[model samples]
Target: MTTLLEGKAIRKIFKTGTVETEVLKGIDFQILEGEFIIILGQSGSGKTTLLNILGGMTQATEGELHYQGQPLHKASDAELTLYRRKEVGFIFQHYNLMPNLTAYENVKLAADIAEHPLEVEKVLTDVGLEDLKDHFPSQLSGGQQQRIAIARAIVKNPALLLCDEPTGALDIQTGIQVLMALKQLNQNYHMTILIITHNSEIAKMADRVLFLKDGIIDHITVNEHPLAPEELTW
Candidate 1:
């Protein structure tokens, strides 16, 4: 598999005056194209920090990052903005959809901003939300709302999708539905996906699992045969 992104000796620190709190300490990893990667860690384990850096929401305090040979670490704010706009899509734990907009409209809003976007209706159908696309966010269930958020992210036709605790807000069954949608996206669109979560069951569905502990990757596990999302136990 080809390398989609690479990080070497990456570190991040948050400083408040004289106080310094180090989050990521010399992390290194490579993400492959079309792979479903899970970064598993407990809270305060720097999983979100690492994801933020990888997604271009923030820069590393030290070391290097390259995306398809582009020097992300050296990229200026303008360059990073372009990189994020053109190459990456993000999904958070909270579905950040506009309450006033219908599912289709919410997704179309993202597609409008993207340089090369997929058809909004097609992306909605891909996530099994075609029937509910006309419904407002408040009219949908949590899982349906999340699927809308997933549709919004994928509509950008992004090469990489970064999700931070995507299913954390749902019940076990609902979480399974969201995971199934993500798995389908991984298989059908061949989008490289990186999800950071503490759920061990969720890790079973990943092609590769990066176990993070205390600001460093504790170990890396590659699943020879990954389970489908529905096969996971809550």
Candidate 2:
């Protein structure tokens, strides 16, 4: 598999007056195409910070970042904006769907901006929300709304999909459904996915797991046979 993204000696520091807090301590890693990776960490472990840097939402204070060998660490703000629009998809815990728009419209908005977009209806079907595409966000359940958000992200045909605590606000059953949708995107659509969460149980479904501790990777593990989303409990 090709290396889709790479970070070498990455570091991030936040300065608040005389207090300088180092969030990422010279981290380094490579993400391969079509791989489902879970970044496991507790609160204040810098998981979101790393995901932001990887997705071009933020730049690292030090070290190098590359996507398919193109430099990202030194990319201009405009360049990063283009990179984000063309190559990356982001999903946060909140659905962030426009309440006034129907599910189809919400997903369509993303497809419209994408350089290589998938069919909006097809993407909705892929996420198992085709029947609810005409429903508004307020009309749907939390799980259904999240499915719409997933559809919106996937319709862009992004090469890299970054998710942050996607199931953080969901119940067990609902979270399982959301994970199934994400797993389908990774296995069937072959989308490269990276998810950051504090939930250790979620790690069982990942192809590889990176354990983050105190702003650094404490260890990494590969799941020889990852479980299905439904197999996950807790």
Candidate 3:
């Protein structure tokens, strides 16, 4: 099968007035369609930097990226924006939900912008937030809010889903619930999902685990039979 995501020799460096900080030295990896990939690393290990590059949310100082066989580096910013909008879904750690808007309205607003919006009801149902849709971010719990965020991301039915510490703010029980929802999306929708996390426990739920350090892939392991999210002993 053709690769759905590819990153070649990606490097990102931040310069702050005579100070140069190297985040990712060189990253090279490929993810096939329908694969669940978890990136495990320590804090400040460049995991999120690599994810940003792959998602086109940030530019790589050096190297290239390919999504669905299309060149990301060569694509213009506008083109990349469109690509991200229609082909990639991003779930951030902070939930990124609008505090003022109700859960349902927030999703509906995003759907209005996408070229092909997913069924609002279906996404709400998928995330188990049908009833909470009428609630505002301030009115819901962290886990419930995050579920709405996940619903918004998958609502467009993007080919790829990128999650960064998606369960960071929640407790164990709620975290598992979020992971279960994500796992269901990956399995049922066949969405190629890549998650960046410091939690090694979450690795078991993925089809493959990529251990990253200093922005380089230290090791990659493919699990012949990954455990179900509910079965994961986190």
Candidate 4:
């Protein structure tokens, strides 16, 4: 497996007045192409912050980051924007779809911005939302809306998919359905995916699991045989 992303000694800090809070402290890791990775941590543990940095939405305060040998840590805002638009896809816990737009329209909006995008209809079908493509977000169930959001992200044909607490807003069954969809995307598209969630059970479906404690990775574990979403509990 080839390395798709790498981070070394990464750090992030926020300052308000004289008070400074360090959120990330010297984090390091590598993500392989076509691999599914899980970052597990409680709220305020900096999991989402790390995911933001990895996706180029935010810059690290210190250290180095590279994507396919390109220096992300040194990239300018314009460069980061291009990287995000061209190479990265993001899915958040909240489905940020436009309430007025239909599922197909939401996905198409993202596809239109990509340099090499997949067919919007095809991606919607991939996420099992083809029949609901004409429905507005409010008309759909939470899981259906989330699948639409996933379709929106995947339609861009991004090299990397970054998910922040993707299942955080759903019931157990609905979350499982979403996880299954994500797993299928990784297998069928051979997409490299990084997911951050406090649900430790979700780690069983990952090729590699990273445990974050107090803004640093406490340990890393690789699963020889990753489980399916249905097999996960919690």
Candidate 3 stretches greater than 4 Å from native: none
Window of ten residues with lowest summed lDDT in model 1: 225-234
Task: Report the C-alpha lDDT of model 4 over 109-144, residue by residue, as the tens digit.
Answer: 998888899999889888998998999999999999
Q: Residue 145 of model 4: what lDDT?
A: 93
- Per-residue CA lDDT of model 1 for 1-234, tens digit only, reads 999999999999999999999999998999999999999999999999999999999999999999998899999999999999999999999998999999999999999999899999999999999999889999999999999999999999999999999999999999999999999999999999999999999999999999999999999999999999989987
Indicate the worst ten consecutive residues by lDDT in candidate 4: 120-129
Instruction: Report lDDT (Cα) of residue 83, candidate 2.
Output: 93
Native-referenced Cα lDDT, model 1: 0.95
lDDT of each: 0.95, 0.94, 0.89, 0.94
**Model 2, TM vs. native:** 0.99
Q: How does residue 191 of candidate 2 score in lDDT?
A: 91
TM-score for all models, in order of appearance: 0.99, 0.99, 0.95, 0.98
Query: Considering only N, C-alpha and C atoms within 3 Å, which residue pairs clash in candidate 1?
Result: none
- Look at candidate 4 and tell me the lDDT of residue 34: 99
What are the clash counts of all predictions, listed in order?
0, 0, 0, 0
Evaluate residue 31 in candidate 4 and report its C-alpha lDDT on the 0 to 100 scale: 95
Where does model 4 exceed 4 Å of error? none
